[model samples]
Target: MHLLEVRGLGIRNPETGTEWILKDVGFEVGEGEFVTIMGPSGSGKTTLLHLCAGLESPSEGSVFLAGKDLAAMKDRDRTLLRRKWIGFVFQFFHLLPDLTVRENLELPLRLQGEDPAVHEGRIEEILDALELGDLRDRQPHGLSGGEMQRASIARALAGRPPLVLADEPTGNLASRAGEETMRLFREVHRRFGTSILLVTHNPRDAAFGDRVLFLFDGRLDPAHALEGPDLDAASVFARLEELGI
Candidate 1:
């Protein structure tokens, strides 16, 4: 089943009257599918993600999560829906610096009013899955970039939300670290069957997804689906060039 669907979406920056960051964007992600949104900087990839996650309202069009129309909901209802169903990973780690990894991972469950007894076991499961068991007691400041990123992901997954939205998740890591993080993402998708919508400019990272869509001037180029062997660095670079990015 399609977990997320967007149609006729458009976003405008109020300050820049001429700039429509996303224009008539549309896409769908099925359960357990890892789809990548790729484009150059300022191409509205992040805006598309924000709209999908209901962080920002679209100027035009509709966004549906699990068949519920986000634009039709009140703010409070939208907030509740996002909390219960969506998981977001930003480019920045966004972990509370003072919180230990264990505490951070538990925050979502606590907010959801899940029982503490269950949280303990769930935390352990996530820590072992992410190979982060040893770092659970460490604060964000004490962890490496990759470790912190993984912790952020762990926090996002703490509630076991079905849909995961990651915006430029690998942007700040070194090449090796980024690759490892991408591998971890694939592993998570494979094991948990979570639908992921990843926004990224890195071609190598985008290539990891089951399908890729190129965004330019706030619209998706249906003609540019990147899949299979066509996802090479050369093809991605050429598409970027064609988009004038």
Candidate 2:
């Protein structure tokens, strides 16, 4: 089943007036598949994720999430759809400084008017699974970068959304921390069968995905999809360099 479908998508910055940030981009993500989008910085990788999540409308073409046309929905309806089916983990942890880790994790459910009694057990399970129980009372500002990133991911998963859009999820972490986060992502996929679209410039990160997509000038090069021994770090980096990343 196709969870996401983007056809001939194009996005342009009205301010630049010169070029399309994303042009003629198209792809489909199957149910429960982990897909990595790789490109150089400023190559519209993040822009594509934003479009997938309906945070921004494409300048042309269509974005369909779970068979629904995102472009045809009003802003309020789009937001509600995203809340019910999509989760996002951004490069920079966007936790609120004033809220404790537990509060931050609970905010999404609160906004959706989910009953606290029904989710309390699930919340505890997630905290324990993410190793965040001890830091539940801590504020985001007090935690290390890795911890903050983990908490951000925990919050995204709190609602158990079917599709996850992660933007450079390990960008701020050290090598070990990054690998740990990737393991967590894999665990989430195995346990929940959630589909993920992860955007990253780092080839090392591509190893986590079932399919790696090379995005150059906002277009996917399907010929470069990685598998088995072909997914070595050297090969991945070489491809990124070829794309001028």
Candidate 3:
């Protein structure tokens, strides 16, 4: 079964009944697939990511995560589903300022009511794998941008969720740091076989995915979806230029 699916998805402002952020969008992500979405600013990329994460409900269609209808589920149920199946990495680290690296990485498990003692090995594994072990006792303010983003990625994967959603994860980092972050993501995907759906404007970041999709004016431009040999940083950049994005 598909790990994620969206059918005829649309989002409209309920109050104004005029503003629509998305319309007639449909797609499916299979198990262990990595997909990247590229779009210009104000094209609803973040909104689409939120919908996929079950944080927002669609006005006219359905979103299915792991074969269950997210739009039809209650808020409580959706929250549970998100905890169980989704891991999120945002543009900003969003780590609690007061928490140490280890503490930040442990937050997701603690939120899910999982015992830290039982999952301690997993936490350590993530820290070591992400090369954040040396900074484990340090708080976010003490770390570099790359280190913080790495910690954020590690925290997101600590749960071993089937799917990970990243929104502009490299946005806050420098070029070299951004490249390292994308490399880390690729390595994680290889090692864990986790599916990733990321939204970014950077062609280099988008090239890490198995397929590249373009979004324009709240809709996915089906004609420009590129994969295999056709999907690369150069091609993505070229396409972006062509689209005036």
Candidate 4:
């Protein structure tokens, strides 16, 4: 079964007249795969990512993770499922301002019921992988934009969740840092065998994915997918140009 499945998902702006923020969106992410969704602002990229992550419930259809429908699970069960199965990384490193980097990582681990002292466990592995050992004690404000982003990514992956949902993971950083962050994501997928669904407007970010999907004005077209060994930044840019994205 796919690690994550979004089926005919749709959400409406309750304040408006039948306006759909996301209209019948659907997709799947398989185990150990990296998929990127690219779209312009207001194209429903983050909204779709949130729906898949269970951060929001769709007004239409359902989302399934590990074969269980998100809309069907009980509140507690869904909470537990999300804590253990899904990881989230946002554009603005949503780290708690007062918490140290280590504490930020620890908070989720604790919530997930994983002992931080499990030696050679996910926390340790991720810390080493993200090179955050020395910055672990620093508060969020003390770190560079890149460092804070790395810490946020580390927090997302520290529990070794099967699926990581990222919304504009590189959107707030300088170009070099953004590139580094994207590379880190690629490496994390390779080293941990985790599935990823990332949404972004940057072609460079989309190029790192095993496959790419384009979203246009809250609508997704499967025919717009770009995938292959030739899926590089240049190809992604060309496709974006062709689509006038």
Query: Number of clashes in every candidate structure?
Result: 0, 0, 0, 0
How much does each candidate deviate from the true structure in C-alpha RMSD? 1.6, 1.7, 1.3, 1.3
Give the alpha carbon lDDT tens digit for every residue of 1-245 in model 3. Answer: 99999889999966888888888888878999999998877888899989998887788888999999987788999999999999999999899999998998888999999877798888888887788989999999999899999999999998889999999999999999999999999888988898999999788899889998888888886677778976789989998888877
Model 4: per-residue Cα lDDT over 138-176, one tens digit each: 999989999999999999987779999999989999999
lDDT of all predictions: 0.87, 0.87, 0.89, 0.90
Alpha carbon lDDT at 46, candidate 1: 80
- List TM-score per model, in order: 0.94, 0.93, 0.96, 0.96
Clashes of 1: 0
Badly placed stretches (over 4 Å) of model 2 are 228-230, 241-245
TM-score of 3: 0.96
Who is ahead in TM-score, 1 or 4? 4
The digit string of per-residue lDDT tens for model 2 on 130-242 reads 78999999999999888898899889988989999999999989989898888888888887788999998888887788888888787776776775656667778787677
- Candidate 3 wrongly placed segments (more than 4 Å): none
Better of 2 and 3 by TM-score: 3
Model 1 gets an lDDT of: 0.87
1 or 2, which is superior by TM-score? 1
Model 1 ranges off by over 4 Å:
229-235, 241-244
